[model samples]
Target: MGILEKISEIEKEIQRTQKNKATEYHLGLLKAKLARYRAQLLEGSKTSGPKGEGFDVMKSGDARVALVGFPSVGKSTLLSTLTSTTSECASYEFTTLTCIPGVIEHNGASIQLLDLPGIIEGAAAGKGRGRQVISVARTADIVVMMLDALKGDIQKELLTKELEAVGIRLNKKRPNIYFKEKKGGGISITATCILTKISERMINLILHEYKIFNADVVFRDDCGTEEFIDVVVGKRKYMPCLYVYNKIDQISIEEVDRIAWQPHCVVISCNMLLNLEHLKEMIWRYLHLITVYTKKPGKKPDFNDGLILRSNCTVEHACHAIHRTLVQNFKYAQVWGHSAKYNGQHVGLSHKLSHEDVLLVTKK
Candidate 1:
């Protein structure tokens, strides 16, 4: 049978199979096979052709955040409200036919926001150009899952599942698993801590399914079988996601409070313009972005134009951000901020920078 047919069959089997110690190995093998087939399917699509219109918008600004949700959930409205870009907003679903790019300027940083076409139920299965939309989302630094307040739970679950199916892990970190392939040595499994969810034998079986016989595996965390498979596939994108509940004005106060209390969630009313500023703040925090000001030898630091860099960024990152060739000079930088030991402390390229820090780089 074809890859899709095989995938469907395997999924059915996995669902029907009982989840007990007796069937653990069987389930593991099936999951590995399913992952392999899905990878093959995605690879085939890569060689298919162009990704089509509007989906290939150039990545710009300090970072990119994708606005993804069901149709008429106010993604377009959010984009328009936050940025100058005018996306076609409507009361009906599927108003956005393609990806529309906008820029949100906040805290001296420009964040590119993309209002993509609304995703349907069978998005992961390539229904309604879902694959294309998700493909663009993978390139983003963060994903903003815009959901209607009334149906926030349902939309959030469905969107999360769709994103997860395509290897987009939201609000998660990459599994702390060290995996390396070898040419001669047989499979070696080691763990820093006790592995409860997966065993060495099961690991070997999963590896053999992928035809990976000679590899070194180290488990740093007690991750599950699926996480191990993701490590093996090594094509997964683990990034932060913000669940944005829109149209909160229509919902009751109790509902809003409950949704707002959830982790990594932001409630807003694009029509009424409520809590939009908080949404911006949440986006900035989730992106882990920090601004650093540059100072001359004698002149004051230029606070008007600050360099936007990721949190825990080093002076070397600042150099690269200023200019690609700035690092070749090989010099130290003076800092005057939280990261600095003292005022105007001379720090090397490896010195981590803090938010709103002042930096003055010296040449060789």
Candidate 2:
């Protein structure tokens, strides 16, 4: 049997098995096996065939966000409305056949928006160029799960499952599990706090399944079995996802209000051009981007142009962003913003910068 068949069998077994304390270990083992098979299947697709056209677009801009959802859900229309790029839009599904790239300029930062082809059911299993689409999504800094307002819940669940099957954890942080492979000592498991979801025996089984005989594991937080499996596999992508419900004009006001109130969700209508600005703002906020201004000695900071950087970035990062060799001869920097201790405080390269901060770097 092939990997998919094996995955299907294990899934079936897991579904048939009873859910209780007695069968937890069995379920954990089955899930670990399923995750392994799915990882292998995705890895094998790398060399399965030639990549489709326009799928391998080069990464650009301050950050990248991918528009992923079912067909005819307004991905193309959203891209066209948000950026200069005009993606072909129609009243039918599958209008976008390739990755269409665009730029969304907001808050002194240029965000790259990719309108990927709509993914169908079983997308993670290589159905309808799903692998290619997901591969592109893996490269993005964030994913925008665009859905139709009418069938938002169903589409969101299906898309989340497909992305999860491909090892994409949307709107989640990496489990606080410190795992290191060692050569000599046997598996040593340590927990900083109580682990209610997964047991030590379950961990051992899952680790042994991956042929991890000797390793050090520490659970800094209480995580589930699947999270431990993810740490063991160590191939998952954890990124923020924005659930964008487009075509809200077709939906009722009550339904729109309900979706808008949800966390990490935005309700908009591309054809009617409603709530698009708020959608952009939510994207920026989820990306956690910041803008920093640069100043010369005895000169005012240029407010028109600012350095776009991720939150909690240090001065060294700013130096590198300015020039690759700036950090090599860097001495110290002066900051004047929220991150600074005082006005124009002298700080080292290790100093973290905040949004709208003014920076002045002095090189050796």
Candidate 3:
């Protein structure tokens, strides 16, 4: 049978098979087979490269975020409102046939926003532009799952499944598993923490089924068979997602209030333009961005324009961000912020920088 047909057969078998102590290993092996077949189907389809028509969307700015939802769910409207870009809005399905790029300039950080094609129920199975749309999302730092307030919240589950099928893991941290393949080691497994989710035997079975005979595996956290499978698959993208409920003007206040209580949810109306700034703030916070101001010799730090860095960025990262060669010729840096002690303390490249910190780099 073909790859898609094989994937279908494996999925059916997996569903038919019940979960129990005896079947966990079998289930894991089935999952591995399913992942490989799915990979074969989408192998060279430009999930990574988005240039030249097929999956075409050039990435830009400090970080990239994508808007994903069903057509006519106000994704285009929201994009148009948020950034200086135009996305065709219509009452019909599939108005956005390609990825539309826009820039969100917030707190001196320019974040690229992508409005991708609307996905249907069978997107993961290559229905419509689902595969192509998900490819862009895989590259995104954040995914904004836009939902229609008028439409029932079922789209939430559907969109999630579609993204997951394409190996886009939302709101999940990479497992604490460290895996390294060797030419000759014969499959060694080490767990720093006590195992609770899955046993060592199960892990061995899964790895062996995937032909991972010689490798070093370390588990730092108590994770499940699914997480271990994801690590073995090794193509999953762990990203933060914000569930944006648009067209809230059509929903009742009580309903909106209740939906807002859920985690990673924001209620807004694109036509009415409500809670846009709040949404922006939520995106910024979830993205874990830290703004660090730089000060030259005897110059005042520009607080208005901050250097946007990821949460755990270091002084070396700051130098690299300023210039590619800055890190090589760098001597030391002076910092005056929460990351340093006293005003303008001299620090090395390994020094971790905090939000709103002032950095002064001196090169050789």
Task: Please name the candidate that would achieve the greatest lDDT relative to the true structure.
Answer: 2
Instruction: Order candidates by TM-score, high to low.
Output: 2, 1, 3
Count residue pairs with overlapping backbones in model 3: 0
Clashing pairs in 2: none
lDDT of candidate model 3 versus the reference:
0.87
How well is each residue in 8-114 modelled by candidate 1, as lDDT tens digits? 89989998999999999999999999889888887888888777688889999999999899988999989999999999878888889989999999999999999
For candidate 2, lDDT tens digit of each residue in 289-331?
9999999999999999999999999999999899999999998
Give the winner by lDDT: 1 or 3: 1
Which residue pairs in candidate 3 have backbone atoms (N, alpha carbon, C) closer than 3 angstroms, thus clashing? none
Better TM-score candidate (1, 3): 1
How many clashes does each candidate structure show, in the order listed?
Answer: 0, 0, 0
Tens-digit per-residue lDDT, 1-364, candidate 3: 8877898899899999999988888887888788777776778455644553535667778899989999889888988999999989998988888788988888888999998888999888878878878877888889999998777479998899888877889998999999888999698999999999988888888888788889999999999988988898888899999999988888788999998999999999899999999999998998899999998899999887778999989998888789999999999899998988899999999999999999999999
lDDT of each: 0.92, 0.94, 0.87
